[model samples]
Target: MADVSDPLSLEWGGRPARGAPGPMLAALEPAAHRYRFQQGARRRSSVTYLDTVDRRLRKKGLSLRYESDSDSEVLVASAPDGIDTTELGEAPVWPALAEQLPAGSVADRVGPAMWVRAVAPVVETEVVSREITARNEDDKIVARLHWQEATANGSPTLARVSLDPLRGYAADAERIARLLADSGEFVVPERSLAEVWLRHAADDEVERRPTITAGMRADVAVATALLGFLDAIERNVAGTIDDVDTEFLHDLRVAVRRSRSVLKLTGDALPERLVARGARELKWLGDATTPTRDLDVYLLELDELATRLTVGTRADLDDFATHLHWERTVARRSLVRALQSKRFERWCESWRQSLTEIVSSGGSEQSGSVEELARDRVRVAYKRVLKRANAITPDCPGERVHSLRKRAKELRYLLEMFAPVCDRKPHRAVVKNLKRVQDILGAVQDGEVQSASLRVFAERMLDRRSASAATLLAMGELSAGFAGEQRQARDELTDALPGFLGSSVHKRVTAMLP
Candidate 1:
């Protein structure tokens, strides 16, 4: 295994102006005294690269592959230069490993995009490799050069040179690159193999998300940000349709929710018709995804949820788990069907079609300093949350706290959307406060959801006869546990409210509005 962080090679090539890899290497032979070139063996093999539907691995400068010639089918993770590899272990079947990579750096980095995205052979090319060792005057090896010609599916595709220089021999490598360039042997191909494969495979490129500035117009800024998110939503729809990972639906739901939030937050600035239509369609989209996502949440948390019971009580929940799993599977099927429907396609098209005129209709109504608008909105939202928080008593209904939670989320989204344009210190302070409040409220809401879910599951389990009496009893105890936690969260709000709505944070919020 090679050290993943260490560079195995360096390379520079331009368009192949003339001749093949052999002639290119032969051209460099004239300077044999300074570069003693010894020809190594010729090797040939087919290499296949794997990537997400959207090419997430390639976008992050990583390439994953399994070389057929290797003894083991372990997926080798490598950089673009094909030098070092981080072996991700072997699976009897390639796609099986998709569910096997743990939640470590590799998973965290690319898992969200690839969640449910299938890993298949995206690029397959027969590569003929020629190796040459360049030695110093003392006959010590200085650099290793490889010339490779790749033919995709029996058709000549591309050729390039790679230089693997020994330690302290970087200068020698650069000289070699210069010599190759001066001879017009090969043109420098700007894209990697993965990038080339992506271009050849599909006409799509990764959508660039927004980074708003203080100077942009309000309507344009909002539209720009929303459009970026919409693009992501469209891209992930296919993966969601395939039910590849829980994240596909998760991301799609988030984009829809965020789109709705944008419309509510900037309703006055955007075109009235556009806002109305977006709200309606986005609402429909969000509603369609809710059942699946809710089911996903329960399924994802099942392990942790099981731990809320005692050692002996854990087995009792098995029947309940089966019931939930069956329901989740059914919910997943419904969600997949919805994503694949023509109505969903039309909705996406309608949303995208509205993009062109979203900013045009506002005219003078939307004209304002974006920074001022952001500040005013953030100020109002924060104050509303503060008022709502203050109104809450220990005896207040759960609905009041839930409403306050919604307000806090609204405020947090506004601050986050405008963060690039806002003052760092005050913006961060307000966001920090908002997050604490949101977390507590979220806990409160989650507890309620879990308790309600347990009751519902209990009834369904009884009807289905999937759950035993022991499981039902365990669920009752679990539901009580959630109720207790909810009470504790509500109690903590007394202390949490003073800090979140304190004079200092209030002053910071006011200062941030400037």
Candidate 2:
């Protein structure tokens, strides 16, 4: 973990002697049978350079050596770690790494005595690296360069400076500077950035407005992604607690939420409620993961704050940090135990079975056509909206109204999805009404989130018994402001509901649905 960002003694140009392959080759050949598990190793170090694209001071090229133990081949890059990885995944530059190897050569023999060779194909490796360097205008060391490369063959590789190690830190700074100067200008197009979003959007459209040809394809894609997410969560829960990270947890939660949301919106179109139940299970999983996620967020913020505290406040900060760490440890332990509980495990199995059943069930229900199912969902949501609207008493708080607003929005999204096949004017009118409700409720929800966040911060500060009087006063002021805003938003929502729900536009939209 020591930062490999500084220039290490460079060694290269090693070649394999003409000879028969050894036992390592036999061991690696099986990996080739799997199509993506070729074995290789690399050592890299960097110095200082300017990151031309970011227009910032960055780690420069140091040295990297890749060797295939099975093939006795090597590849070396006198480039920034990021660029070196990028080249492997993308097209080669002039005098490219590819040219350095023999035609059909699987590896490069490089350096004095041909001692090093890059074993993996340039197109099959992913590269991720990061380094810490001094700011261009300040002496302060800060984390700067970070890059991730995912290659065509689905193999991932990562390299990062070990900032906590003193030597690694100095080398990281030197590597950044050297990399900028030595590496040639090579740019990867930004188009790939849209792939995930576009893929999801297309799936959403097909789910919302399925064509005969696209229906099965879209469903399978969505289902597959959902399964992947579920599997990751299951692994995280059943595995060691130390393996969990904030980003991983967040990604898992999002996958679950999106899958549930999509299923809730379109499940009636399927032959059974299996998908619906699966969605409910996902919601349960999300709820189970919430405490650990909240603690993760708190720990991150605490770490950030700790770095900025003065020496005089060190004792108090240490005490608070210890308390937070204890809390996180307990939460993680509880989460792991809960995940292993028979009740939770049974639910997970059932959920997975439901998904498998739905995917296997080939035929659609009577109401399976996209238009019909969309209308049904819209009407169902509308009924809930009406019920909530009717129950809204003057005494109801903003939180309740905000919940209603979400229900209204769901109804509106469904209607809009089917608008192409339905009466557009009526659908648009309903959407407008829904928007009005959403706006009012959204304001209230924002206030609620801010207020809750402030309250949590205040409680943490108080628990540490180190909060300043000024901070306490500010928290009180924030709470009062949020309360006032929440009240105003709730009143606005209530006052608008009568006209909004009873309007001629609303009635017309409801009439057109069925």
Candidate 3:
């Protein structure tokens, strides 16, 4: 491979139908006696780009694609100062090879993030090009250029010049760049080809949580933040219903949960009637998706779960895997039905319209200044967590920790919403404290759920008489392990409670509030 520093690209646009690369190259071609120019026949082909649904590869300054009529894929990575390395692979989907390419370089990145994401053509382009090499008197190649015309899907055609200079010929590359820039009315474009392609190919907007501006009215800012989440719920419905990807369902559930949290955190600042209605509908959505999501999690972790048993015992889990697959199919069908029903449609529409009205409403009785409201909510939530934390003894049931976890989550949400208004340093400290409590609580809760779920699944398998006794035995072992872990997590929570609800954390919460 040649040094990345030796190549330069000069891009420019022309009337979609009217430019000839020959004329551009002619301007730079030298007198026959002084130098030699060899031009290859123009070759035309299409190029298709591959990337994750989120555009992760492009974000890393990498262009990954397979050219039409070609058997290999190429990844072109660019860095600062006009340096780039292009790696080619024989496989069309190159995750395995890319993970190991040029160790410690950017080329070796992104294979892990691509897990569960299908790499498909997000954009396509047509190119007509010719390669020209300039050789000196001794026939040693001094420089090379690839001049091409590229047309992105539904975009205007454009001209491009790629210059590759031999070592010690950096000045020659610069001169070639100038010659290309001067051709016709060539000028640098404000956007890259990838940007243009992405713009044209982009689907609907992906909703992002809004950041509240400081000093904004409490009701207005809270309403805006909640609306951002509402938008996500609405945007994700079609994708989730269509089963485009697991992420769609996951993101939809998150939006619904966050919306419910916002209403709870704000308390009476939002109208009572509005909060009650939204909470009821959001709860329905959450419950409706639970079975499917649970099944998704189990199915996704099946292989890892299988590895937990000894090699011989692992084969006994085949029946269990089959049962999970059947369950997922049933759960997914029910989820899809709910998502597509008229009731769900009406609920989403009503939720959005009602929230929008609330956000736009004139000064109302329940509304208060944001800072005062935030302080009241934060202080109240913090007190509840502390009270719950104090009630738990070392021997308390895991359910107690789970309840405290819920309270801790509520407090965390409150702090997050008020972060822009509160003292940043203390607000972060308060949040950090709450998160530690939540993490331990989460682990305990998850273990309980998993262990209970496994027991139920194992019984169903036994009742059906579909699984061998070995399968039941393996499941029992797994359940015991989960129960033990759950107990350990409860112990951890008990030990960590003091620092979490202690005076230092109390002071941080007090200092955080406006």
**Candidate 1 lDDT tens digits, 1-514:** 1222323322334343233446555667545547888777666666787786556776767766656544443345655454433343544344423565543454444455465555656777776667778888888888887766666754445766677789999888767766666566444555666556656665434334555666777777688678777877887887677666677788888788778887898767777887898888788888888987887787777777778886436688788778877987888787777778888788778767676465455434445757777877887887789889989998899899989998888887788778877878988888887788888898889889889988998998888878787999889988988999988988888669999867899788777764
In order of appearance, the predictions have TM-scores of 0.76, 0.45, 0.78
Better of 1 and 2 by TM-score: 1
- Predicted candidate 3 versus true structure: per-residue lDDT over 64-109, tens digit per residue: 5556544334554433333343545454443223443444333434
For candidate 3, the lDDT comes to 0.70
**Top of the candidates by lDDT:** 1
Higher-scoring candidate on lDDT, 1 or 2:
1
TM accuracy, model 1: 0.76
Report, for all candidates in order, the number of backbone clashes: 8, 46, 1
Q: TM-score rank, highest first?
A: 3, 1, 2
Candidate 2 lDDT: 0.48
Model 2 superposed RMSD (Cα): 16.8
What would the per-residue lDDT of candidate 2 be over residues 1-514, giving only the tens digit for each residue? 2223333211111122111124223322322222222222332222111111111111222333332222233333333333222123322322222334433322221222122111222122323222222332334443333322222233222212122223436554444434432332212222221122223333553574322222343344334444554665664452224432355565566556655655677654443566756766777777877777766665666544444433333344454455557767777777677667887779778766755665566543443554455556667777788888887866876556776876776676556445555666776767777788888778777667756876776688787775666555555565567777877887887798887668685577666664
**Pairs clashing in candidate 3?**
218-370
Q: Kindly provide the TM-score of model 3 when superposed on the true structure, using C-alpha atoms.
A: 0.78
Overlapping backbone residue pairs in candidate 2 total 46
lDDT of each: 0.72, 0.48, 0.70
* Candidate 3: RMSD to truth: 5.6
